[model samples]
Target: MFRQATRLLVRPISRTGSRRFSTDLPVAETADESFVEAWKKVIPNIEPPKTPLSFMQPRPATPSSIPSKLTVNFVLPYASELSKKEVDMIIIPATTGQMGVLPGHVATIAELKPGVISVHEGNEVTKYFISSGFAFIHANSIADVIAIEAVPLDQIDSSSVQKGLAEFTQKVSSASTDLEKAEAQIGMDVHSALNSALTG
Candidate 1:
């Protein structure tokens, strides 16, 4: 009679969802190594399309030029009735910073902060003030801006706008950092323009 010795081990899955290696021993002694190699080489047939996540969808190529159609939304009261013909691009006060969205932009959702929003169509520029909110932009030449509070330049009170500018100027003068000073200056300029638009 002859006696044989064998070793076996088991390993569990890893934290990253990968299987852990077990000790090098099989429960069955007659297992064929060549058969195991053949099985490893075989891959399950994938569907003609959408098999893998990467191949499930086709990616769009980058556009060479801006689209002809453009749409924009403003948070200011009565902004819905504003003319869309004079606006080609919008400058939004985003939470991270101001965002300039041009036509043919990819879809995106962003949080906005309280600051000035500007619109530029050709050489003409229009500005507005928006209190914190969110904005959404889509590839279909549409932009939506929703803010907690908004007042168009022409609708704001002149005295209040002047007061805001004066305060912004003082803040700019007292700012300790370049960033602070720059922000304050922008605020002052935006407020001034709002006042001009209102009182003019």
Candidate 2:
């Protein structure tokens, strides 16, 4: 009697649920080696198919002690803001609230709102106003922050921000269609956050 070599693994998909993996359903870590080997033996001409695991970097194991620093990679569509920068802590504008992330933080994916992301390193703090994005915090003290539009707070023009805020406020009240109203509201939110980041 032969037994299956595959072992099952379960992981959380949401706040209160989990999904199970089985032999019938495959994952990157459980790619069918037997099938690949058979294919190689039969044809020996083509390369074996690559799994998602092969394309992804292996996750580092969690350390025993809380790390002193967190590795951050802040990225934008046009440029990479911070590449593997080690920082003491970072404050992100999450939808729920401003969340301060530190080393050894539990793995989470935070939906960022229009606000400022403050990267704190010792006594130096760098601030940037982001339109919106997501932050992925991993268990290995690494955080990947992705934003669509971000600019240094110092580089922003206060007068321009105020002017835009006024325009958006007028647009909000004058908007006739639902789409226009939503766009105006979004513009207002972003400007409000920008104003707060500058003033606060």
Best by TM-score: 2
Backbone clash tally for model 2?
0
Give Cα distance to truth, residue 195, candidate 2, Å: 1.2
Instruction: Kindly list the per-residue Cα lDDT of model 2 for residues 11-102, writing each as its tens digit.
Output: 22224445433222344344445545545665567675554445565556678888899999999999999999999999999999999999
List pairs with backbone clashes in candidate 2. none
Which candidate number maximizes lDDT? 2
lDDT score, residue 132, model 2?
Answer: 94
Task: Give candidate 2's whole-model lDDT.
Answer: 0.82
Global CA lDDT computed for model 1 = 0.62
Give each model's whole-structure lDDT.
0.62, 0.82
lDDT of 1 by residue, 52-91 (tens): 3322333233356767756776544544624444368888
With candidate 1 superimposed using the best TM-score fit, by how many Å does residue 129's alpha carbon deviate from the native? 0.4
